[model samples]
Target: MEGKTVFVDGALPGESVLMQYSSVRGKFDEGYVKEVLSRSADRVKPPCEFFEICGGCSLQHMSSEAQIEFKQSILKEHFEHFGNVQPETWLEPLQLDTLGYRKKARLGIRFVTKKDSCLVGFREKRSNFLAEIESCAVLMPKVSELIVPLRNLIGSMDAKQSTPQIELAAGDDALAFVVRHMEPLSEQDKEKWLNFAEENDIHLYFQPKGPDTVHKVWPNDNNDRLHYQLPDFDVELAFHPMDFTQVNTSVNRAMVSLAIDLLELNGEERVLDLFCGLGNFTIPLAKKSKAVIGVEGVDSMVKRGYENAKRNNLENVDFYQADLQQDFSEKEWAKEGFDKILIDPPRSGALDVVQYLPKFGASRVVYVSCNPSTLARDAGVLKEQGYRLVKAGVMDMFPHTAHVESIAVFERNN
Candidate 1:
């Protein structure tokens, strides 16, 4: 212990515990708590029965407040270490439901001949095998309740062994499940699935090939999309089952409100939103600003953004398609000066785009980041470009996991 570092899975800070080593390395060792001789006040008994084995959640052992504090410390450390700067104001941590908040998930499906049944849930921790779980604590109650019924439904199907996964998506008033089957489903299997959907009052879909092959199987309705609303902005977004949407509805709503407030947009200001999928922030910004431009890399999402704008009757917003990683200064949208900018890039961060933010002549920038390290690195770049980090804080978008979702606001140092 004196010569090397040890990473314990279940042990908390300031606690003595007996641990069993699972993996040994030259630089460090990995282990889990076998016995806790001493405990911290922050430690709590995980509410989920499958938390011990399920890989879905890692920080369930820590109290909810402690988890938020831990994430905040991580963000602070990243800012100090990578960016060499700190925000002037540390915002209050944004949080919502600690459990039953996740509205989307990709659950594993496994047919075990030994048990003569099918298993449906997340994979086991540190293993490739699926965990045998009947209910999930983090998923929405409607989706969690479908686990056992989904298992039984697959078990009764002729293609049980071929169905490998189920994709879940939920909205304010609708829930949908997409069954990914490797083989063809018999007419009887289809009927069974339809009956299950009808009884559960949920939409059912089938994916015999790829994501493009996913099609609704129940109710035979023309509408194949699920929607969520940002009631504060009077905006509603509709998306297909395969489309990427925020998993926590409340957190997303709160995050959007925070980002918009940080921008301090006036009716005369023009705003630009980068990586704006389905006009999540752009349309809302349009409601408060004079004009808004939404740019995305994917073609389908660009179309979806336009479709949503039309649905909301928002003529002040426009959607554009561009690879942010490349130079886009020549484009008409990029040439215009923006009063404020909102960036919600992927995990890789927006280094390629952030480096050029100063050229856009934006007075303010609000960045929503999923990765602290990348955010910190980009913050350093922004500092060099004469933008001062003003306010920053973590959001409990993912409650019981190590994932850190944070937002930072920067004002141009004019």
Candidate 2:
């Protein structure tokens, strides 16, 4: 490693420069600048002053257009290189707001004992230490602006010694700040958090340890649960902060629409929603189909799905709990068959379930993924099962970042 400036900040491919090795996790070992680099031609200067140090936005140093271009190309290359089957249509990537768009974030907090002060924000690139930040540009303005105040407020807290991090969550109009505290908040600390929320029109939550134990320091208006709307069918989805809701609500809606349209339900189709969480797409699909069975590995979420379906008056949707990777083909599974299917699993993709689909007799499978490589691998499996990749597309759920959310429709060959 040399003592030279490294262009680790969005250097194009083919350019070379002096960059130190970043030892941090999820960090590139070497960084370089793109002098004669031939990139996607949509490069731009990052808007943040701490662009190089902040670990939040790696692609922000690149242009937004290039980010989407790279995402689209990533899917394209995976299909060509791994799946070896081209999709009929590259459904345009669903793009959304660039800045102040993130609804959820987990920020780092460090007490600079030497300086006798506290620093609150994301960590720096290649460093375990926290980046002392005054504000963030990418997080929603409410949470972003709270960076400095949070530091000052926590610094004044009586229990600041036992605090490690703060999680920011904003749902619709409700703001929540869940503090990770090793020690309980004192009376003064609670007052400070209360005044901060009241003066700033924000809400504050605290976590003594795990997510299940998180509760509000002060009672909030429970009338407004964290909810988002499905505009297509005027359906509302109320989810807890711990629930798996996409931070980007706009792209989520587009994803649900695409999945439903691809399934092409005729109000008589039996749809199987696999790895479904809180009925993100199940209840809405229920409105258009004869019946839907939403299944998930987490029993709490399966219970939530049932509650959500009942709340929406969607009697056709039934939620079940099962481990798709293991017992998906148990003797009881044969009792239910699907004419169409929608799968929104985690980054592992739905390989295990796709392999089991052939036995149950499915007509179509709409796979939603946050990782493209796994999707391609599972696509290969579906292809072996006599399914054709009809259409595929990207959703810019996380703009100005490398996170890619994609969807593909697999239709059984006639």
Candidate 3:
């Protein structure tokens, strides 16, 4: 204990200080330095009261500018090592409101009636105990307000001990909550949720299993047809709560703008959106391009995408269901040779699609990804296939949390 140094969350590198263990490794994996120890100049006081204790965000203590600089390095190192090429121009990283902007989250739920109260919140940094938060600063204000009521609701559950998690989804038309109960709910539990929904004007989804098993209890038709609007496109896309979407809606809107700008679209150009989910980039691209084809792996999502296109009166858009890992070169894809392409794959990034990217006949391609490591790998493939990495940058989609979202542009070498 005399010489061993424990890594502390708030203590920046090069700091030294005395410390005691408070389950330090899990929540943040270190002790608060009694002295300055060694600290990075970028260190700053976290804005949230629950910063260190809550498991939600790990980098709030770092300066906002520092966060971006470090993230940019992660992206650069990834592309340099994995993709083996650098971009012609590094586009400016997108930044949004650093606090109270998160619209989606999964909250840890617990009920301990012995304290004459119910405790529902996020898990402590490295412990199973709740953070005992009054509110969360990272969540949208509307969503954040539910924290207290959420605590009370868990206390009312018949099997309060069985409540494990709460999935909060806020939509344009309605608010829905998915309660992950580990055991059978009593009739009283159902009624409590019913009364809560009625009073708060929210919908309840009970998830006995996975997202697929989530069901509406009070309203037979619980889905209020939620969709996030694209900028000036006048397009609305319907998506389920479980679907993958950028957490910060404002940043997503800006990301769509950057992706569209980098694509350099013309009215004559047709674009391909690979790994498109509910046509996030696809529909928006259609606003400027001649037509857009969106390919996704999920059949149901593809069907919903087509329907959404119809609802928006965008007849030029096409939605196809295809395993992105399989060959996309066929008569179906060849007939519609794309002039521009937008790839917004999941955290795995667009690894397999990079090989087919150049062959798609696109002169320009814009890629948006959440994971830098995978993006780096695919960037290498793109560079090898004769596409030059034109521009790239990161987006702070989820602040406080270390998750990074980024956009890159690739153009075929003339």
Candidate 4:
């Protein structure tokens, strides 16, 4: 091997290992660890038996603290490389329970005629084939225990081959399983699922088509929403099973608190929450601010935001629907200035929304990002608009993985 860069999987820094090349590129090469001649001190035995094959948790071999440090370094590198700037002070990484924290996930479903069983888990590493797994260490305990039973339930059904996915959405008290089937389930098969739901005391839903076709089958309770509480603000936010939410409940609570603390809201200030889905942060902001306006891209989420605001008995919060990727400067809500702003955008980041910050005249901005690369790029844009990167830190949202979830604060330069 020459001096060209090589991207190795299953290999750690300060370790020597035998590698098998998977692919070759003009700039860099890619490979995996065939055998480790030397091991890093940070490497540890993966707890899950399926860690070797299952794609669910990638960094299980690394210590939890080491994983967070690695993510922090990645964020730091992104800021220096893309933004050409760094925060004046780095905040300590926010952490919580690393395992048994994932509350929502879309598990792949496949029936193997050879094994005479349905495989229910994530895909195999670097492959599209589903991994044969009985339990997941990262998923919530209640959902993890259902894997074997769910496999049996699907294997015994006539529509096993037609069921391609099973999505789990768990709240503080309720757990839901949304089975996506390509064919109609036989009445007997439906009865089995209903009995299982009743026995497990969980909600069950069927999705024969798209997201719109998803409907509950058990309990017949008109209440389809799942709620999680922010005890810090005495606020509870209700969301649909398919809506976007943080997977780690405990980490989410801590992350929301951290974001609000960074904003430094006063009782007299008005706050703007961008990409606010279902009033997760908006409601909490309203509790500390004079008024809060939440803007989201989806209409359903806006309605859900209103629903959550009313559910929590908060009248100072308002929800609005608008495409955050496009300009809405002339919109009535945009005309009203905000004293502080909080943004929690998807992995794509919020370049379009960040560009409009100067127009809003917010003195302080708190940005929560899942992608450090995009966040760094947006940081550059904010710098050009007369904002200084004040402080930043990473949060261990998706532990045992390379995904980086971080928060940054920007203050307008005087």
- Enumerate clash totals for all models, in the order shown: 0, 1, 10, 0
- The residue-by-residue lDDT of candidate 1 on 320-365, one tens digit each, is 9999978887889988888899999999999988899998899999
Candidate 3, residue 110: CA error in Å? 2.4
The full ranking of all candidates by TM-score, starting with the best, is: 4, 1, 2, 3
lDDT of 3: 0.79
Clashing pairs in 4: none
Best by TM-score: 4
Q: lDDT scores for all predictions? A: 0.92, 0.79, 0.79, 0.92
TM-scores for every candidate against the unseen true structure: 0.98, 0.91, 0.90, 0.99
Pairs clashing within candidate 3: 14-38, 15-37, 15-38, 16-37, 16-38, 24-29, 25-29, 27-125, 27-126, 83-380
lDDT of 2 by residue, 1-414 (tens): 245434365565454444444433332344434343354455677777777678777777677777888899989898878778778888877887788778877888877778878888887865788887787788888777778888888788887778998777667657767778898778888788889888887666778988888877544765424677888977887766656777776777777887898888888998888888999899899999988888899998998888788788888888888887675676464467789888888887877888887876888889999988888888898899999998999889888777888999988998
Compared with the true structure, what per-residue lDDT tens digits does model 4 show for residues 140-227? 9888898999999989999999999989998987999898999899999999999999999988999999899999998798989898
**Which residue pairs clash in candidate 2?**
6-19
